[model samples]
Target: MITSKLMRPLTTGGVLASTVLFASGCKSMIVFDPKGPIGEQQRDLIYFTMLLCLIILVPVLLIAAWIVWRYRDRKNNRAPYQPVWSHSTKLEIVWWGIPIVIIVVLAVVTARYTYALDPAKPIESDKKPVTIQVTSLDWKWLFQYPEQGIATVNYLAIPERTPIKFELTSDGPMNGFWVPQLGGMIYTMSGMATTMYLQADEPGNYMGTGANFTGRDFAKMGFTAKALPQKDFDRWVADAKASGNALTEEGYQTLAKPGTTDRMTFASIPSGLFERIVHDYSMSRGAPPGYTLRAVTLSEEKKAEHTAHPKNGQLPPGNGAQKDAPDAQSLGQPDHRSGHMHLIHGK
Candidate 1:
């Protein structure tokens, strides 16, 4: 049937459309942009590692294929059956020494670059590195500039090609901080700090997001990282500081609640905002665990009377006749006149 013949092409067309749509939806697939020295070093490291791996892999793979085709049983008509011969010093040395050399080379190269790119290190620049404190909350990101006294949610803007250092922490669960074109992803946890460096070489807007899995709105937990000229960035900051209401301690307490979606910016940032977020005082209160000891002592204090005698009334406070020696008479027969009883009473 013509319908049946058309179905195959139609199905293929649908599959192709879906694949293109999926890839298009994820547009920020670009890895590293060599804006700053740090990003350049990271890109270099990746390229070098890949190139070195291919060097050893390509030769080994080609040699394997050549041996299989040249020594096939069909070409020889009769393959020799011989006793095992294991000892080959040259081949064994080549295989073992090659891998060892590769590992040593990789280790030395990676270690040197890793220390150089340490976030705490001071990179040489004509101007000072801008400081930004980032806090990850449940389903939202808070960016605060202690120096500028401004705050923004889900958006960060800095001068292009200027070194920017981020001191990152979290108020809620853990999250990953990533700006794909700028650099790699790092983690943020409550009460702990992590740092990352990035600079936009090209003056443009880049997308950044949390690479870690969070709750419902995790997919939308992203923002725009804008790189602008110094003058333009300053103007933007000034305009933001003048437009909206000042964010105070009370304002932050209200915003600290979970489930903030998309982006919001605060015109005025509260003083000591970062410190308060780190040492959260608004946690729910409860009786300390050491209260159990107090409970036991109070229970003992509340008891009014304690009985000592089982056959009759409570015994007196002291022993009227103390026995200096063990009594042999009570071993065989019941002693009804035992006067060595004591009573404890709490009132």
Candidate 2:
């Protein structure tokens, strides 16, 4: 059955598979090559967890192979014959106790990091965070720089070492917002805005994409995240602001339609557009009796709400509001600088 014809095809297939594997292994792994603080911490945790598993895995595998070889049924096996030996208290304790101790250690370390690396937690930097609104569309991603007054489709830009507060929401199904080299994936769901704080420590070109399944054009839902120096970022913003393609209400409506398109930029965007989107999505035509949620949209308006207790005001960005969330002043503000309207929307 092992003829030359069959052998030829098998050899060719093996060579092709090896070549593909070698080529793939040569490619860059963005996660392992983290350029940001969050990404680096996450990568460390991954390596630690993997090594911890290997601590158990390696020894268990080696012992299993040794047991198989040493205890095999052979003509002259030298292994001890303890076939009826199963229950030893010392053995049970060693086997069960080792795994239990490892699990506890893992749980403790994991819990510590889970709290430390929270996506909402602010970075310890002197620079005021730049706020960017992110909207996941039918098959595209939209980014609006509220402070910079510019918007881009399938693209992102930020200054190095400055924290970026991304307010994420979706016009369609829940999509995963991920920039692998910056941090982990944060979800953008319809009817609500989710908060994520990410920063890049180095100037580099990075790729971003929707990490969840959407529809037929899901593969095309990728974007570029470029980290530039402060001066260069400002220059880019100024150039975009000088451009003529302003996105108005009508323009945004057209852009929101379900289709894939090339990179787009707008010199200006309608005010309160992001707040309106969150409000509209949350306020359905027929939401039951009274289902309303306070969204964390404008960090500026939220800032004014916190200056009531000036001590908390000193706290950076989102931290103060969260600490004093139960305070009446923290609920919503009377007006927003972006829209000059009530920050809170009623049913």
Candidate 3:
């Protein structure tokens, strides 16, 4: 009867655990389902560290359990008790020595992997790595293929078995760029560029997104990374060129607006666009051209009007001359007197 009762609860618990595991499907676990060389290395490191920790954890847990059971107070009090006992040199040495050795091993392994997995570190390959410039917008991702002379919004394409070097920056706010099945996450910051290297060993589609919580629409910031064979990738590039959609300065500004956007492809982009973007944010430039100038001018105008007409206390008329102001149809053209244009490079 006792054996049967014990078996009933054990069977029920085992069934429940299995059901839970079944409900959480393996497909949802991307870390364990890595598809790239970088991800495989990262997964291996995780497993190594976990195994090292378990080596210590299991014994400590077992010892605690044994001590609790054997030293439990009972009527017979057979367990040895020495109230005056202070310390054991052997026990101290064993505990301290083991942890010190584990720390030394962990430190060595960590340092080795840290340098080996650096995103900027080049991977050994016969074929040259492809470079892609990535810009994180308010709620979207923009990918510029400088070598291919094409760009895409919220979509990325790479050739399989080839290293891809990604240069990341943010046009809106700081965020994390991550493709969990391909590699580790890296931060994208304004006024700076970061690098990450990744390569897919097989042809497949992987999910990528901004891992950091940036803004209200952050949840919608995601993109698809498709890895294809060299031939297929070339075909896709040809198709993108046939699409005949060119990315211009004005179009980029519009796309950078804070909102969700669908995936899009561009046939061509202006030369040195990525370089200009970095230069605009660099310390030498100090601030984005036209951004601070307009704000300062507007503030000075408001202040001057208030000071000149203290009794009226009214703001000045817009831009001081309505006749010279460009019409709505000619909005992009520069206003001669103000020397200001709404669009960058008058695009």
Task: Give me the candidate number with maximum TM-score.
Answer: 3
lDDT tens digits by residue: candidate 1, 41-118: 888998899888987999999999999987677844775777587899999999899989998999999999989877
The residue-by-residue lDDT of candidate 2 on 1-347, one tens digit each, is 66988999999999999999986874578888888989999999998898889889999999999999876799776778666756799989998998898899999999998998999898888999999999999789999999888999999989999999999999887899999999999999888898999999999999899999988898999999999999999999999998889999998888888899999899999999998888887776223333233444444444555666566645355555556444345445533433322233332
Which of the two candidates, 1 or 3, achieves a greater TM-score against the reference? 3
- Of 1 and 2, the candidate ranking higher by TM-score: 2
Tell me the spans in candidate 2 whose CA falls farther than 4 Å from its real position. 1-27, 75-82, 285-347
Candidate 3 lowest-lDDT run of ten: 292-301
Candidate 1 ranges with C-alpha deviation above 4 Å: 1-29, 73-86, 281-347
Candidate 2 residue 321 Cα shift, in angstroms, is 51
Score candidate 1 by TM-score against the native.
0.71
Cα TM-score per model:
0.71, 0.75, 0.76
Candidate 3 achieves a global lDDT of 0.84
lDDT of 3 by residue, 1-347 (tens): 89999999999999999989985875588987899989999988888888889889999999999999886788876757667868999999999999889888988998899999999887778888999999999899999999999999999999999999999898878999999999999999877888999999999999999999998999999999999999999999999999999999999889988999999999999888777676666754453455523323443434444555678566546665333333443344555776765432211
